[model samples]
Target: MFELIKKKLKHTDGYPYLLSILEHCLQMTYKRNGSQLQQWQLLDRILQQIVLQDEKGEDPDVTALENFNVKNIIKM
Candidate 1:
């Protein structure tokens, strides 16, 4: 098995082309923090909804909380 692997590695056709394709694949490296749905900008909107109901000073529309769907903004 080792001999076969060595032979395949030494004889890879179009190795340069394969390398160029692999290099492109490495470009999309991702960094992540602990924030799920990292929509930091949307934080203010949600906060206003919970803190200040409306311009007329009504109660917060808390029922809409049940309809909140993270999937609507991002896919798993």
Candidate 2:
């Protein structure tokens, strides 16, 4: 799943689409595991990709939460 998302991130043009994908995946993760530590780890990985893409000037929306942490944004 992560691999597929990474691939999509690479090809995605709009930041909104990527953000939606991230939100959907995060919701799925929470539904599956109830916000476990592993879920945050997964979110971190996802955020890293967002940050990298944003750094490259690919997705501007990603920049909105470039410094995000699961604890700060996600309410368990």
Most accurate candidate by TM-score = 2
Which number leads on lDDT? 2
10 residues in a row with least lDDT, candidate 2: 29-38
State candidate 2's TM-score: 0.28
For model 1, how does the per-residue alpha-carbon lDDT over 27-66 read when each residue is reduced to its tens digit? 6344465333244424444655757676677856666556
Q: What lDDT score goes with residue 21 in model 1?
A: 51
Off by over 4 Å in 2: 1-16, 29-35, 49-76
Candidate 2, residues 1-76: lDDT per residue as tens digits?
A: 8677777676567656777867876676344555555566666767676667754568645554567676754566
Q: Report clash pairs, candidate 1.
A: none
RMSD, one per candidate, in order? 19.2, 9.9
Q: Residue 26: error of model 2 in Å?
A: 5.4
Segments in model 1 whose C-alpha atoms lie over 4 Å from true places:
1-12, 32-76
State in Å the error of residue 76, model 1.
Answer: 16
